[model samples]
Target: MNRLRAVPKQRLLTSALLLAIASPALAQVAEPVSPSEATELDAVMVTGIRGSLTSSMNLKRDAQGVVDGIVAEDIGKFPDTNLAESLQRISGVSIDRSQGEGSKVTVRDVGPDFNLVLLNGRQMPASSIEATNASNSRAFDFANLASESISGVEVFKTSRAATATGGIGATINIKTARPLESEPLANVGMKAVHDSSVDNLPKPMQGGKWTGEMSGIFSTKTDDGRFGIALSGSYQERDFGYNEAAVGGGWYAFPGGEGPLANADPAVNATNPPGPGDIYSIPQNLIYAINGVSRQRTNGQATLQWAPTDTITATLDYTYAENRIQQRRHELSTWFNQAASQTSWTDGPIAAP
Candidate 1:
């Protein structure tokens, strides 16, 4: 009979082993993935202006109250040298310039005195060269802070109980960079600025000069990724000039209640009789002034961070800033006095203290 020969045991075993090794089911099983590898795959890195815009949008979307923000384009790089100038880009925000440089910010219809400024999360001291007024009393001088030392700025229009309570306008929070947020980094920048307003004046009146600014940032982390440090500093100097015309002294009303006088009232023939006037109010004093200002700013910041465990972190931060402003004013003033029956003029130089 054509009976099949007995299958060899070794051949049968070898065929079963080959089938197991080549099976699709065996090949479909995946190896376990490590947490670090998975995190890397999901991480997204962004940079430059677009990154700043993206970050700002995210902050707005996630904030609990009405808020706006500006994020730095990169390490030590902000949208503008003046923090007030940068805030002007936000809606409902306005800025006042000092000698053509942004120095103060106003939010909505609220004045500067109604706004509060915080460094990091704590209230910082306020300062200004202006005499105390509705706008300068509680206003922080943005010109004293350096853009290079800031990582972002946030303005909170609506407040919660946890929020700081000084501002009726808005709360401005300045954020600084941290070392553990990135890998080793270094950035240095220099800028030269010229002001045409003062530079184009006559030789004796020209107070404008080429202004220079320098800024730098350095950051690094430990090999174990548990400790980090960051340092930033900036310096700037500027010279500028401004001119003003003003009228002082009370206006004079014509006799017989005819009206105010533009010049000495002829009808009042008293030796002086309200100086010079026609039918409109008379200007008793005329003043012209040219002012020169020189200003310098120095700023610095340092931060250290440590994470001893996955759930524990500690940080230490320090900041310092100094500003100096010197002003000189030249004035030519004319005075008309009916009481003294004399017209006088004076010219002199005034130095600001």
Candidate 2:
């Protein structure tokens, strides 16, 4: 017989003794647990946004330097369209917009040229093309990498022993999924994107439309979990644009008795009757510019891993990516002759026409 015991307190003893007296006696024989019952036991697996956030918190806690990170909800499930867009979520990070899309990042108010980007611990070069020449800019274009097939990204805001020497502002490390660490799996995804602002463009300036993206990943390992292979690929297309009205030619300031507004003396146009010494001016040019941009990106990676012992492992991987862009610009502007009939002006200390 087993006894339920508690400290011998005056009030506690009454409840313990009553409970023990009311309960049934236990069996002395032990029973075996069935295999079916053991197999039916519940198991918990972390996944989705909660899992990603947990992983990110862990990465920050474990990484060196002032590190911040973003982890995927699952394989190939980064929510942003590209790397720069996702990076903007971190504090002290901002992006330079190119054709209405995030192109490069500025960390801690430092320019992108001084920042370094790494792929699986190897520094990657930055390159882009122009009409007349191929300029080798140090700024990495984050728009080139498809957001799919990502495992995580870590940003080091300060230098440490492991930090590469050149990136004074920050060092960015992009991580991809590895097969050996994962269970066998296959996944495919597709997307369609549309930019409503394209419709706001003038008839001749509006050609952008919906685009499509496709991506997939596959991973497998031998029964022993020592040898594994992972393959991933993504193709994405996008149409984007920027439209604005501005004085791109720059403003021209006129003196008291100069320029078209100064020459024209209309009593109704002036805030008050214009004196000969009053200063006024007209716009250099009223211009509206419409810009359209299109981009196509493709990415592919293959990884193979072999681990013969718990202490040592060998891995080989190959990654390839390509980005192509097409752009066009159209402008409509206004200019007036200095003659009083062609233009009317208001006289004041400021320029107006």
Best by TM-score: 1
What digit string (tens of lDDT, one per residue) describes model 1 on residues 1-353? Answer: 23344456667899999998789767578677877777545677878899989999999999998999999988688888888999999999999987777988999989988999998888988788654333436789898898997889999998867668988999999999888876789999898988766753456766657889899999999999899999999899888877889986543333334323334444553432332232223466799988877778999999999999978889899999988778777889998654433433222231110
At residue 292, give the lDDT of candidate 2: 73
- Number of backbone collisions per candidate: 12, 0
Each candidate's TM vs. the true structure?
0.73, 0.71
lDDT of each residue in 248-351, candidate 2, tens digit only: 33233343444555445444344443344544445566788887766788999999999999888888989999888777788889884445444345644654
List candidate 1 stretches off by more than 4 Å: 1-44, 131-136, 200-208, 249-284, 338-353
Give per-residue lDDT, candidate 2, residue 11: 57
Candidate 2, which segments miss by more than 4 Å at Cα? 1-42, 128-132, 201-208, 249-287, 333-353
Count of clashes in candidate 1: 12
Highest lDDT: which candidate? Answer: 1
lDDT of each: 0.79, 0.78
